[model samples]
Target: MCKAKNMIIENIDELTSRGNKKGRRIVLELVEETLNQVNYYNIVKEVTKLTNDILKIKDLELDLNGFKNVYVIGGGKNSSSMTRALEEVLDGRIAGGVVVEKEGYTTQTKHLLIVHGGHPIPSSDSVKAAEEVLRVLNKVGKDDLLLVCVSGGWTALTSKPPRGISLEDHIAMHRLLMNSGMTVEQMNIVRNHLSQLGRGKVPMFAKGATTIGLIAVDEVEGKPWGPTVPDSSKFSDAVRVLVDFDLLDKVPESIRKYLETAPPSEESPTPLDYMNNCLKVHNLVIADNIRLCESAQKIASKMGINAFVLSTSLRGEAKHVGAVVASIANEIANFNRPFRRPCLLIFGGETTVTIVGRSGEGGRNQELALSAAQYISEGSRIVIASIATDGTDGPTDIAGAIVDGTLVPRARRLGINVTQEQNEHNSSFVFKQTGDAVYARNTGTNLMDLILVYVE
Candidate 1:
């Protein structure tokens, strides 16, 4: 490594690696800083703040008004944590509720029923438990208030099927949608519009129950995915998403047939009537991608690096996106444009990894890091990292990976090429051999990935 290259690596390592050395302390310090930024305290604080902004019907003494009982219902990776926050706010007012969350993450409360469910795909248990919830919803009357806590993973965790549609059909369609190239927002537009349980099924069934969503948003767009407030999407709009993505032809045969035959009618529910009460009553957005972005920036600044928040809502394909970030770093090195030396450019958002083949060990973030390696000049002074905030990126324990300009030769030495591997979605294998994978444990419930590039 040249003098400038060594300086850049030192600066990056100082921010990512932890130890007692000057660089180590700084790296540890930064990780801690970002970690602290996402502590239960801050998450609770933001959630509390949002909840407070809503109409405080509790102050009106719902019990006194004859709308006595308050029930909790939720689904997401953040569902359990969010339930805890809701319990703190509602105190003893909560009668009882059910919440489904990722395995090993549960929050028990006096009145909350926590259910463990699958993610990225719905399971039989999710449907069974969700059906049980529907039974509970059938019990709710006009006077009772139902507090629904919807977050990132709720789509798969909560469920009800449309007439004549098989559970297998729904599951297959969901899997295809996730693996498809459509964004969460675009996917949800079609999903919610199509499903009986979605498009405000919870709210409509529990009509006038004061539905509230404690959303931990994943999309870059300000509006949370799925039906939050009044879902503005029409059935045609939903179909158009499939058309635009060219994925309508790829969805499960049953789902495609259903979509083709389904009539456009007023009974085709969306989050309209319920949205009035839903948005007004909804409390927190447990957290957002921007929180993680700012946290990374603060950490980089502490490392004596000039930090820049590229964007909180960056989106697009993982490969193209990685290439763009790499281009920026190259420009910084050659032209010192946008940012000069000792710069840490940070971006946050969820990127997709399209696997057209059998597969290998890798997530979208890792693939992005590998693809970026080619754009970095050999011996150039730049290092980049892309990791999911949730700690686990994709199915692997590795959160993301870190790459320096030397990664190109490093991959070549391992009998791999960056461009070729990225095409195969074999980033995990490529980085594993070159030692660029960034694995972390306990990243918590936050979704989305963070990209950091240190350039000199």
Candidate 2:
């Protein structure tokens, strides 16, 4: 279990340097406590156990004596932490395995090959990791046991481009999808169509082995996707998403041709196909976004704060979501309209940033916080903050940013142009200059982004 003392945010003093001391304390405390509550290691430990050769996960049980070999495999932001727990529970039962994770996010392991790869985009290392994992999976036999640990960000961490498509073209396709304002689900649908180790293909390589899928989700449904579970999306769906986003021409010609060709044999396993296959699969959602938000709400309530979870499915562009959250807070503070004053509103989910020409550094959460700063009034006493649960926002090391009513005036005094920063997608630069950027190393877990609004 994660302790409050094990803070993922590295620059707490700097973040609390300018905001209302009490408000900053409350907001930062909520972030620290919530992250601890939903940590992957703790969640995995809660649902899994082993005793005298009978391995149990949640309500399912398996007799380890029947299997000749037990192999652990999969990848994601939190896979390393999840693997640590699995290694502890199973002890020395694990024969060998290959697990992939984002660069700089690996943990110490005894019986597994931990491969560090790229994130938000795949690199040559990502492709190599995918190959290594596939090679391990192919070695599994009918009597073998396969433990698949997957989390958000697995799509990029284990990359294997399909035949006729080069790695460069594959990476270019992902870049287009990221900046095209498509949701993560939409992006994965396109990705599931063009990879060898994705869309439930990993399990296919196991050669009839029984597979247990442990998933950590970023949305409310808790439904698992990617390599461990069957994808309901088809080639046509990928083509339509590209067309809907107007990215058909912008994506690489190889990807465009692959999606347009829509080969039936290359299609991912449908739900029915997966069910009838020889691969016996059991899937469980270990943790999710709603669980993370609820933990935050509960912690605030215990502190005598009126906290309410607005939605765990918050979506749309980052800038727009920020404005709406600020507007709601404004109404509550000035008019007591939707919610009364002295309340904490919580939101969770991933947001997209549609990059136009000349994009700047930053992620969606930082953009959200920066946009909210524009509408805050000095006397409103409203504090708005956003952070990626994984402790890395966008391509930067900052987790997210926090802003208050004083942010706009501070920017003016500093000679910073808020609108220009937003237009250029430069939230990281603005927040860093103002000492409000929340910095942290990778948290070894990801559910999505968490936004908190405190009105006093």
Candidate 3:
């Protein structure tokens, strides 16, 4: 479904002066197409296809005779559409439940209850949705099933603060926490600690319910929601996050100055396994960065470029990783230790931006792309591109950047403001001036970002 492909570089004129529009538009279209290629629906379809063998569809496997029914429940940006697919597949078997997602989270049938919540920042409406989810879960029985559709935004969107710490404080802490560079798991530990409704607490509201977890792992690695299916996150780990962020004082005074009190983080009690009977929590990874790398590989092979997929779960600071990837490609070209010249190396992962500077477009992909571009300019014979699959990088609309050897000279000649751009943390601007920014409606699903370094 993603048809945006590469065009041969016939001449430099296409990206020079006024004629550069075509080059810019081509790059943008590529980004758009890739974004479209990664939508939740598309990702869900891919996930279902890959996991078809695992989904127990037939009631024949076990005794469904006395099982009252199955239902849907969850909250996130992608929860509704994904849950709808589940409802469509299960039909009458899915009796319906509460699903809280973005504002337009509507089910095709009137039987299901859809709740709208805020994103990035959870609003009062999200709190109401949380209450509604709890209310719905009260009706569950031993044989009932919980079909929870969870995506990246669940930690903030699906939860509400306890009796004391208000949502305002919760959000403030969350922003501080995310910008702090702690892993999502570490972040969630604190989050679950502050909230009354987290850990395995979601299904506890539903007595004897078996959970089917549909998840999108953005920051954490491997099994998403490990804390849910009876695995643990721990309360002390939450406090350590606060300490790590140097915000031990910022957490609400009632949050029990966890810094002054808890034992060593090594000896902390993680999220309790509250479920009486639990399912491994069937999680079919509907979407991830690996798909992007595979797609990039296909594109590269078609273009007669030797391709490689580095890693799907690559993590760390964007600039550091960018430099490392660029260095590797340089080594491959100069020494051919891994692969020879004219190779296309691709990587997929969620990279973090340590934004020490203020007033910047903080997308990690762009920052990394810029760093790679700088390396290419220094004689790597490389053309570089990196895009966030969600069509958004940090807070910018541009997916990422693309660059080549000529980028530096072009910027120097055209007064393209290189240092200023990087200083401002505007990867979008630097790539835009050189006709390299990718723009899409909504191509890639999840948080998969693509980094393509071309040597030829």
Question: Whole-model Cα lDDT per candidate?
Answer: 0.66, 0.86, 0.62
For model 2, residues 319-406, the per-residue Cα lDDT tens digits are 9999999999999999987888789999999888999898888999999999998988887788988999988998888899989988
lDDT of 1 by residue, 1-456 (tens): 123331312233433442113322333335435755774334754545324323243222233245657777777665666667767776666677777776644555456777776666777776776776777778776677776666666767665557677778788877777767677788787677555557455666675665655566777785554434446777677668888877788877766766666776633454455544453344446567777778878767666688899888888888889999999989988998987876778788887766565666778888888888888887787777787766667767676777776778867877887777777778888867766666554444565767777776
Model 2: clashing residue pairs?
Answer: none
Quantify how close model 3 is to the true structure by its C-alpha RMSD in Å.
Answer: 5.4
Candidate 1 lDDT at 7 equals 30
Model 3 residue runs over 4 Å out of place are 1-66, 102-113, 252-286, 302-304, 333-337, 378-381, 408-416, 432-435
lDDT of 3 by residue, 1-456 (tens): 223253212222333233224333333333444445556655554454213223453221323444578777766655665666665556456676887765433434345777776665667876887788778778777787676776666656666776666677777776776676666667677776665456556655677666666666665275666224443656656767788778778766756453345444322223333422443244445555665567667765765667788787787877788888888877876888688877777777777766554745557888887876666644446666677665566656665666666676677777877667776677676776666565544332555577776666
Each candidate: RMSD: 5.8, 1.7, 5.4
Which regions in candidate 1 have their CA more than 4 angstroms from the true location?
A: 1-32, 39-41, 46-67, 104-111, 263-272, 275-286, 302-304
Highest TM-score against the true fold, candidate: 2
Q: Which regions of candidate 2 fall more than 4 Å away from where they truly are?
A: 1-5, 219-221
List the lowest-lDDT window of 10 residues for candidate 1: 1-10
Give the winner by lDDT: 2
Cα lDDT over the full model 3: 0.62
